[model samples]
Target: MTLCPSPQFAIPDTPCLVLDDGAPSLGESLHCARDWAAQLPRAKYLVLLCERRSHFILGFLAAQMNGMTVLLPPSRAPGAIREILDAYPDSACLVDDGPPPAAAVVRNCRDFHPIRSARQPASGEVSVPPEHVAAIVFTSGSTGRPRPNPKTWASLVHGARLAIRRFGFDSRHCIIATVPPQHMYGLETSVMLPLHSGARVHGGLPFYPEDIRLALERCPGRRVLVTTPIHLRACVSANLDWPAVERIISATAPLDKTLAAHAEDHFKAPVMEIYGCTEAGSLASRHTTQEDDWLLYDDFQMTVHGEHCRVTAAHLAEEVELADVIQLKTARRFELLGRHADHINLAGKRASLADLTARLTAIPGVVDGAFLEPASVNGATTRMAALVVAPGISEARILERLREQIDPVFLPRPLVKVASLPRNATGKLPRTELLELYERQVMRR
Candidate 1:
């Protein structure tokens, strides 16, 4: 909340982003935020493309200095970019090297420049109100359209401090994160933790198992790898001598118990899995091998309401409904029961089926449509299937229009021509029937 940067945090006059190794320093990167605050108006919101760690952190802090909200869009995917662009028409995209090819088609680019001075912003003694929305992050929406969730600076910091305590992050620690800095989990752990603790963060999203090992090799002293279950599995499978790696954090998707066991056995490091989504920064964390309850972020309260999980965030000063279906044990700790019906899983990532269905059914030519996964008829088809209703539109035209909006994974296969999809009393769906319908209508025929 304090506008003045922490004294313990060391800021060098040198560049944060290294062109040779493509690694950016925290101080140098945050300096860009300061520069932007000085340039932009006090109330202008900034839309930052989270392609790299350097750009994400810089854009975030810059918004804070300017007292503007920051919007972080997931990388690369055109549908994801278009959604954010449509949502925030007045926002400017922060493109470091060059504006992304997809974003270029949407609007003119306002290029960002590196900070030249070390002076802090004018609001040195300011405290961001707990109610103020500091940033907006979209849930990856495994089913339909991605939903935007706004988070206050206080809430974000509160969650980060809670994470710092559980993970034992301190000034002496250095991290090499494989996760993108834009997403909530990655943003808090990789960027906020460093600024909060005055620690160093190696800017890299190591993709390959060997790359993860190399990142550790490049960074010394209490190196932690913030990654996913997919990357963790690959890292263990690589069987590299990664003695320098002390801690590992997995998020974004569910971590298999079998893979967690394999990870600790091979790496001799603790595998800590964080639970939460873009909506709630991070609710709690449980160690892979330990039995300790997920230490909830300070000021957070959880309650199971019927089949859904709800949260009372004292930091945000608001109550939020979470996608997770949790078993309420107390206001703080509880076991997770996968996702709520708000999201349906297909091909590893979760999508918003409700949002997709709404979009398809709302179109002019389409009367009513249901999007479901196609079953494996002869056990040959690998992807899910869907059924739609468009009496006048051709299959190619229907697919083309939907493709312009939704991610490819959510795209319906075979484009089953249907009169109308079955809807319940509240126009709802039964999970089993949705899958069954897919099998009968699309798979068999």
Candidate 2:
């Protein structure tokens, strides 16, 4: 708890955000946040749509200071934006990008400058009630429709402090994140961690391996790369000379160990994975190359009965039941089985879709892949189908390899070769999109 930003946090003069031009101190950012908050339109919720990390942080703080809850949409898709806006009638959209997506009272982040030095408020510190609702983060709609999860200010701060200690992060470490701030994983590592732990974060949302490399090069210190499994795979495969990195953190989807090892070898940095969901900001961490069990952060407790697991913590208002299957190894350690949704019972035989997909992607020429179990029709289960991204490997060859590793019941009926999977920024394939792809490519054939 030594690194935890106190409940009555005092703003610091250390750099909080690193931009191409210069680094902005925490106090400076707060000053601008208050100024911008005063001008923003009155609303009960602020739907943030800023692409720039700096703007997102400023908007996040401004909304909170003004007592407006920040609403993070699951994605930038028009349908997703509309869904959130329709649900929250008193929400205003804030965007730094070109134009707003929906028909609402939209405000542009470009209209206000957050880095402009101005007269500091008399207190020079931001203090909000611990019970204040900070943000409502939406779940990634991988399985189904995105659901909102409200997070309090105290919970956010507590999660960040736990992360800082777990990752050995401090003000001296510079964060270069590929994931966008709207995602809960990105919000914790890229935004909240720095705000509470005194770490400096690069403002750019780097996606390409080269962009990530450049972002790391520009920062001066031990650098941490906050990203997802898809981004890590791209970086490892790029084969470009990477900059010195202190560590690499990945989440949003389960990371393949081989890819994690390759990334660690290439970057000469330890690769770590986070295990959590939108309901809980971040729960545990594990060094991928070293172990399969996840070590829960201090004060987190887990209990399992049958296949369902419930997690409890002081920061959480109530115990949260996890959707995934878990095996408790100790009081604070556990092994994560695939999600309940990914478990398939086919022809009296059971198999995990996630495990099968991992096996397919582990093939020599496979770039990416996923196993899809279509909905049952007339009480009869359908054969599972697969989508693969291996230009060098044929559908037959991929199936042959899968046959050796998995049971015959689990082999894909028609493994469709594809250019790419429809992965979002966080590397999650939405079920709706996957089914659409299946219909367009498979049924049409």
Candidate 3:
């Protein structure tokens, strides 16, 4: 009925993993949980992360077994991390080398030893209720900020089980993750999905195009690739024979149809996109090789009201208002028009409006700036554009700052130089109206 960390399908003598590289066995993973629970008996909540995917899986599962709340912010930005820590009150943080600005730290999964060579604590068991707070996930709010939505242990188990059935994964599946485990998509697919479905996990978040090809080459087996749509296009364009992959899953933002088609044809693997967020974890995934219409979650119900998407009596939340804009046909089927808020979808990656604006505002050379996603030919969504201070900064230099902070897709395509952006009575730019400004300033130009 629940996740037991049962590595029933792991290949015998098969190389499993930790933060360093390939370094743990199934029993070793469980043992890590026992040691962690023992070390921090008094801590009720923990936020743990290892730069390695394997350690993340270990810490998260260990926390579940130990009955602690885990906080997951979509981005690793200091602002987001600080907010999560503040919300949790007093909580121990689990970390590897890359840590948040916060104080509490745990053993780096790579270097951490078992605290004992010959003793294993008796397996600790905790009862989990569907209403209990299992993990907290943060979403960039429409009002240019972050908000947390909590999910239960039951939700994760149900979501993982449903995805495995839809994707045809089993113990035979070996996954290489290009996305960080912080996001709901990566956490579910790379960590919980692998553990529950009996799949093996690999390390590192591949950023460059070449690293993806190299990662694929290193791991050999029935491989599944977990990545965002932005990474998918880059890897496909890298002009390398991608490793033998069985399935590819894309999330974060919406996928370009052309890129999806190209990926399947080039990699000779089925390309699928997940319709999900930090709030719901993963709701649906449509096989790009087949159709764009997302196949609804078998375990959850989706309801579209007005321009907002809401769920009733879910494994995760009730009366949950999602950040996604959906068109509902029935209880289980729907189409995504766009997100419900300020977060923009660019080539299947998200750039927080606040993060973008904050960076532009921080650059001393700038006065004021705002980013926009313009509407395009036959209304096929176009690239992002920005309105920046006309005085001190050159357009080329301004874009460089944005590129360092956000993804390439989110960078202003033509770069508009203007006095300032328009705002409503309360100083908000509606999504529909934001595109109008892009049209007048950038697209028409």
Most lDDT-accurate candidate = 2
Worst 10 residues of 1 by lDDT: 11-20
CA-only RMSD, every prediction: 11.8, 2.3, 9.8
**Per-residue lDDT of candidate 1, residues 229-289 (tens digit):** 6567667768888756687888776666667888988888878888777777777788867
Give the candidate order by descending lDDT: 2, 3, 1
lDDT of 3 by residue, 355-396 (tens): 666666556687656766555556444676677765877998
lDDT of each: 0.64, 0.87, 0.66
Query: Once model 3 is optimally superposed onto the true structure by TM-score, how far is the C-alpha of residue 214 displaced, in angstroms?
Result: 2.4
Q: Which wins on TM-score, candidate 1 or candidate 2?
A: 2
Model 1 per-residue lDDT at 379 = 37
- After superposition on all CA atoms, how large is the RMSD of candidate 3? 9.8
If scored against the real structure, what TM-score would every candidate get? 0.69, 0.96, 0.71
In candidate 2, what are the lDDT values of residues 1-445, reduced to their tens digit? 2222452222466777889888877877887888789878899999998888999999998988898999999889888899899999999999995678888888888788658655343233566678888899999889898899999888888888788888877778899999989999999999988887778899888889999989999997889999999999999999999989999999988998999999999999999999999897789999999999999999799999999899999999999998899999999899998898888888898888889999999999999999997768775567899999999988889989988999998888878888889988899999999989987997678
What is the TM-score (0 to 1) of candidate 3? 0.71
lDDT of 2 at 283: 96
Question: What's the ranking of the predictions by TM-score, best on top?
Answer: 2, 3, 1
Better of 2 and 3 by lDDT: 2
